[model samples]
Target: MKSSLFKISVLIGIFSIVIYACKDKDNNEKLEETVLQGTATIYVDQTLQPIVEDQTAVFESQYNVKLNLVNQSESEVVNALLTDKTQIAVLSRKLTKEEENHFNQKKIIPKITHFASDAIVFITNKASQDTLIDLQEVLNLLQEKESKIKALVFENPNSSIVSYMNNLAGVKNGQKKNIYSLNSHKEVLEYVSNNQGSIGVIGLNLLVQPFEDTKQYTDKIAVMSVRNVKSQPNNVLYYKPNQSNLGEGLYPLKRPIYMLNYQGTAGLGMGFASFVAGDIGQRIILKSGLLPVRIPSRELNIRKEIINNK
Candidate 1:
């Protein structure tokens, strides 16, 4: 009787251990399999917020996911990603070597994917008669040299546009007295619209496809045509920030937008990143007036016979 009782007790202990192990395995499997469902926070450059918002809206509606998009300056976005505050970020530029090295130390390989092309556009008040701007003159303005521009307004001091223009003009520190930095892109538009002789530097996405909130100001501002400084004096060509110009590489202020995913797991970040790079997301980009990384194809059927009746 004593031996039988001991055997029964051992079997019960083994069964409990097996059951606990199976439960733990099941929980892990569920966590690993959840791709399109979960919460993810994505930090996006302020300049590209309009388009990113559009992408997020569609993505959230299509899947059981909640995307918290934090619109911030370029520097802030990079900081968030490096600090692990957020696992995903959208920016006009890719991560620097030092940034990638930091991730390498942690055994994480970031997935950077280019999704679209954007342009930096210059806008002025409608009252201004100067409908065209010379690229050299713009560079000269950035360099604090005398130029045709009276004043320049930027979205933010730390924005990608400011960095891009500074690099282009070879400006190490400080800016011209006439140059100014505001809090947001909308403020830039409002200031330019209300104040004459002020040229606003903004992203092309807002002007090309204005959102409801920005349409009022965008309607009041006039987009200026930019002349390429590299072009010969006699062969200088001015291009506008349109889809055709961006697609043909005629726009000199064009920049590529990239999505960086550092989730390091099959989480919602991976799913959202895939969605943005997939067909539906590219179509949203195409409709937003930005140049999608991959142009969605269209099929058309042609009839061999044409009937003309008068």
Candidate 2:
């Protein structure tokens, strides 16, 4: 009887251990299932299309998520977020106060994160001698009713771009004679590349890095410089757009690039938001000739043995 009781107790102990192990295993599997999975639309501005398309692909591959991107203007993207059309938005600027109010009314505070930096580049044909001009000069030329020089923008429907022009030119009366808009940035580039007299105002990311074996974009066009705002006649200036110039604040047209989210912690949007603020992500921005908001310093150590090696 004693032997039988001991056997029964041992059996009960083994059974309890097995049940506990099974429960723990099940819990782990459940935790692993909680991954960022879903379909989300990233409404983007036309200005960021060229750059965002590449970044989105890389991000999707890194994080197992599907991003449905819709190309639109900044204002359009903001409107889409307010209307519950998209969960994420990538644009040049953040939401205005009125847009913020929409989120607040819904008891949600939108998240705004600065990912990378960009510049509004001015490009002119190689034949044009007018390579350097101040913002005042640009304003004067764009606002002058009698000026013969024509200015081309990305799109007429782009209110943000239009507003920038209006603010810079101080156009209270009406639209200027020379200021016009094109269908797309590619169209603007092609038009200005072929026409020696035209000046093309476009986002810098499109033409920053060159293509196979040569400077693809620069072959067709020459980038102009904005004169220094402080110097006399603004003679001293940075001509070409590069990481150094942009990082050092020599680039006059630099703008803070942003990604806005209507909600903070519910979707793949948060994942992307966190990644953009990470070091590896910021490095991608640095590699693109654009300044990263969080700069990282790389330390290289060359040993004496390696130096003596060849």
Candidate 3:
């Protein structure tokens, strides 16, 4: 009887150990797979804030999730991701090789999803007679060559627009004398609207959906159509950063928008990334005046009988 009791106690101990192990495994799985119902913080490029806010609103309403968005300059966004401040970042450009190396050293591979196409637009005061700008002229201004515009105003020195223009113009060091960096896009708009001969460089998203306080300032400014210098045969077509122009690649200053997820697990970051690349998120992009990565499908009904014209 003593031996049998000892055997029963051993069996109970083994069963309890097995149960505990299984429970721990289940808990880990739950933590890894909780995609639609958790809290996540995302760093977003300030220029893309308007459209991203729209996406987060619908996503949070549909799922039991909370998204905290930190809108900063593109450089700050990249810095936050590299420093592990956030696992997800929305940017106009992909990570550079050096940036990827940082993640490689940490054994973290980022998942990048291209969601939409955005544009860098130039705006001036409505009273300005120059309604059209040549792409080459803008580059010349960046290169410190003589140009029609007196100065170029940008939101932030570290913003993506400034970086893009600098790379495009092949500027090695500081910006040209004519280029100026302000605190925010609003200031750029206001500065351009009040000062003639100065042009504001801003994201098309702001013009599409301006804030209530800045609506009047938007009206006071004019969006200039850009003449593409890269077109073959010296094409004379000028295009504005409208939906159709951006979709057809006619816009001269177009950039791709991407969502980079470094969560390395099936969490809310993954879920939000999927949501942005999915059908509904594309629709949101369409409504926000930017070109969706994939055009949403439309179903049309056909009738055999033709209706009489009224």
Cα-lDDT of candidate 2: 0.71
Tens-digit lDDT track for model 3 on 257-291?
99998888888878998998899999999989999
Give lDDT tens digits, candidate 2, residues 220-308. 88888776544565366545667778777776667777888775556677777777767777877777777789797789987766555
Better of 1 and 2 by lDDT: 1
lDDT of 1 at 265: 80
TM-score of each: 0.85, 0.78, 0.86
lDDT of each: 0.87, 0.71, 0.89
TM-score of 1: 0.85
* TM-score result, candidate 2: 0.78
How many steric overlaps are in each model, in order? 0, 0, 0
Looking at candidate 3, what is the lDDT of residue 161?
A: 90
Q: Please report how far candidate 1 places residue 222 from its true position, in Å.
A: 0.6
How many clashes (backbone atoms < 3 Å, residues ≥3 apart in a chain or on different chains) does model 2 have? 0
| Top-TM-score structure, candidate number | 3
